[model samples]
Target: MLIRYSKILLTAALGALILLVAINNVTDYATNYQFVSHVMSMDQVPTGSPLEWRAVTSVTLHRLFYAFIIAVEFSAAALVLAGAWRLLLRRKAEAARFNAAKDVAIAGLALAVGLYLFGFMAVGGEWFQMWRSLPDAEQAAFRFIGCAALVMLFLGQRDD
Candidate 1:
């Protein structure tokens, strides 16, 4: 088990390194991916600047970025289910099953919120209207998911 965890950690480190490298390459190659025509929105743009950064022409790239975000969110949520399955199969600590399940469920909830964020960005609905007009309350309510999951996990882990 220790070796498995070590490998997972190493893989995660390598993934992070790869991402860093990729982002650096993207930054270096920023000019090759643009073909601007007009300013997108002057209302929200800052003025008195040497370089104009309010325009966009990378529609293909934008869609890919959006799709990638959604894919990542879904993948993260699915990982929770995957973790639970892995735990059930390999974890011999019957006393910890509930806690483990709860942890996985919390992970799932986090992923669901990621999905929701993508939805909100894509839909562009009024952030505080047409759905009860309780943005703060909804945010607090969403936070409860992880809190409840954590409580369940801790309670299950307790000796009672």
Candidate 2:
């Protein structure tokens, strides 16, 4: 029971963190937008690199990409928070019931992991060569993915 509560709380916490990130991005749109633009432009990558051709130089595309990121963040947060709520409502139920309520949370965490691991790291870091930039976000994405993955593992355990 205590462990179930812990899992619910951790899921909520992660959801809150993601919500905050989305809010920050919306509230400070220009600042974060610049980061996205820079990464997409790949201007910071070594000038002569062969991968430079992969850069997305269009301003419209940068805005679209940033918008997609915000949308995913919001969706993940909503799902995780809703899952936590469902868990809280069923906290006193049987283990099977509680376990059944974890699906939404698991989906949310998976989205978060996918966002950071595939969206940011694989696409931005490797494809766009964001790692070569001064203000790279690959480390941040790694940390986020790690935390989300750990929580997903913990939450997946049976509540017996």
Candidate 3:
């Protein structure tokens, strides 16, 4: 029972977090959009480096990338919310049956991992040199990724 509730709580919390992120991305669009713009354009990177060639200077691409990120965040939120509800409904079922219902939550976690770890840390931080920006967000990126990983680990445990 405890394990079942734990899994449900973890997923619910993750869902709430992702939903808030999506809301922020939508309501505060210009702020993060600027962050994306600068990162993609590599304007914050040190001048006179050969890596400057890798910058994507186009505003259109920046908006497109930011939109993609928001979409992923929104999708993850919806999946995890529905997954949490599913877990709640199946909490009293057999362990194997309840565990089998975790697929949606797992998919949500995967999307979050992809966004914070692969998308921000790998692509934006390393590829676009976002870490070198004057106001670097790599720390926050790592933190978000770590949170998702911790929740995923908890969710992966056997309910039995």
Candidate 4:
């Protein structure tokens, strides 16, 4: 029971954190947008590098990318929070039932991991050489990925 409660609380906490992040991204659009824009533009990458061709210089694409990221964040937050609610309601149910309720939370965490790992790290960090110009962005994405992945693993465990 204590373990169940801890799982539920951790899920809720992660959901809240993601929710806050989505809100922050929406409320402070330009700030995050700039980060995306810079990463996509690859202006921070060393000039004349072999991979310079990978830079996306289009502002339209930048906006689109940023919009997509924000949308994913909102969706993940919703799923995670909803899953947490389901877990709370089923906290006292049999282990199988409680475990079944974890599906939604797992989906949310997977989405978050994909976004940070593939979206930021693979596309922006490696493809765009963001590490050269914006190592902090890569680090931030790593942190998010790590947190979400940890919660996912914890939630995947059977209650029994």
lDDT of each: 0.39, 0.92, 0.90, 0.92
Please give the lDDT score at residue 30 for candidate 4: 94
What is the lDDT, from 0 to 100, of the residue 119 in candidate 2?
89
Model 2, 71-125: lDDT tens per residue?
A: 9999999999999999999999999999999999999999989999998998998
Q: Model 2: residues >4 Å from true position, as ranges?
A: none
Instruction: Tell me the lDDT of candidate 2.
Output: 0.92
Error of 1 at 39 (Å): 17
lDDT of 3 by residue, 1-160 (tens): 8878988998899899999999999999999999899889998777998899999989888899999999999999998888899899999999898999888998998898889998999899989999886335998888888888889889988777
Please list the residue runs of candidate 3 whose C-alpha ends up more than 4 Å from where it truly belongs after superposition: 134-136
Q: Which stretches of candidate 1 lie over 4 Å from their true place?
A: 1-57, 87-93, 118-123, 126-160
Best-fitting candidate, scored by TM-score: 4
With candidate 1 superimposed using the best TM-score fit, by how many Å does residue 153's alpha carbon deviate from the native?
Answer: 10
RMSD of 1: 12.9
TM-score of each: 0.35, 0.97, 0.96, 0.98
Residue 138 displacement in candidate 2 (angstroms): 1.0
In model 2, which residue pairs have backbone atoms overlapping below 3 Å? none
Model 1: ten consecutive residues of lowest lDDT = 34-43
